[model samples]
Target: MKRIIAKQEHCMGCGLCEVGCAVQHSKSKDPIKAYNHEYPKPISRIRLELNKPVSFAIQCRHCENAPCVVACLTGAMTRDEETGFVKHNPEKCMGCWTCIMVCPYGAIKADVSGKIVAKCDACTELSVPVCVASCPNGALECKEVTS
Candidate 1:
């Protein structure tokens, strides 16, 4: 399965991935409209892991031995064998923080409302993830990784 990989050294901290991701998830799917929307603004599945000199976009690793899936009591978190992507079902989620606590990379995060957990789904619904597509520096790439 293909996963988003980052070239940390090439990252310029431009943050276009965040913008694109949010817009893609928003109601209108328009940058301007999503930014200025009154309610339920879009949120990003991608996050820039910044630390002065080293910066990279971080998202779900979709681990082969996913701790998130093991920790989730409600069975909302699952690993798809065919796609090798860890899937999260918000409706089945009980807003439990088990997944967050066990994720080594701290990829999973709670929303502002705290009603559901969010993480990179690899944009399975689309051909390419917004973050990878919006990267101006070509720092983000989707490739298959061996467990």
Candidate 2:
């Protein structure tokens, strides 16, 4: 399966990934309009963290035995068999932060309404994640990883 891999050495932390992510998920598909709405708040499933010598974006790993899936009591989080992507259903979510707490990478984020959790789904509906497409520094990418 393909996963997004980050090279910290090549990262510039421009935050373009966040913008792309918001647009991709937005109903308007417009960054400005998307930012003004309630659904997508330009939430970057990938977060750029910088600490002097180290700087990189953190996102979901979509683990085969995902801890978030196990932590979700409402079955809101599940793995897609076809794509190997961990998916979230807001309708089934109960506003619990169990997945967020259990995720070691701190990738999951709360929706704008704060009623559900949100995270990278590997852009299963699109050819690629908006973050990967919007990255100007070539820091974020979708690549296959072998177990």
Candidate 3:
């Protein structure tokens, strides 16, 4: 499976990854409009964690045995057998937050209304995820790894 890995030492905490993710997921797919014009605001699948001198970007790991998938009572969380990526079905989600509680990486997030969970889909629509491509300091990389 291809996964995004972060090198915290190289991260500068610029938050461009979050911006790119929001734009990519936005209806307008524009940075300004995604943040300023989009209703409920576009949510970034990737999150930046900062501790002064220490900072890093985080998103779903797409785990081989994703607990979120198991914990989801409504089956809204699922693992893509072919791609080894975890996916969420918002239409089926019950806003139960069971996935959020079970996610080991603390990667899942609630949408603006807190009605459903959100996490990285690895931007499967694009060749490369926006978060990795937008990393200014080479802090994020996409690599093939054994699942």
Cα lDDT, all candidates: 0.88, 0.82, 0.90
User: lDDT: which candidate is best?
Assistant: 3
Alpha carbon deviation, residue 140, candidate 1 (Å): 0.4
RMSD of each: 1.3, 1.7, 1.1
lDDT of 2 by residue, 1-147 (tens): 888888888788777787787677767888788888655365657777888677887789898899999999999999987778899998899988999999999999897678888898788777877777788888887888885
Per-residue lDDT over 33-60 for candidate 1, one digit per residue giving the tens place of the 0 to 100 score? 9889636666888889888689999888
List TM-score per model, in order.
Answer: 0.93, 0.91, 0.95
For model 2, name the residue pairs that clash. none
Regions of candidate 2 where Cα sits further than 4 Å from its true position? 37-42
Candidate 1 vs candidate 2: the lDDT winner is: 1
Output the lDDT of residue 19, model 1: 93
Report the C-alpha lDDT of model 3 over 1-147, residue by residue, as the tens digit. Answer: 898999999999999999998888889998988899889898898999999799999999898888999999998899999889999998999898888888888999997668988889898888988999999889999989886
lDDT of 1 at 101: 94
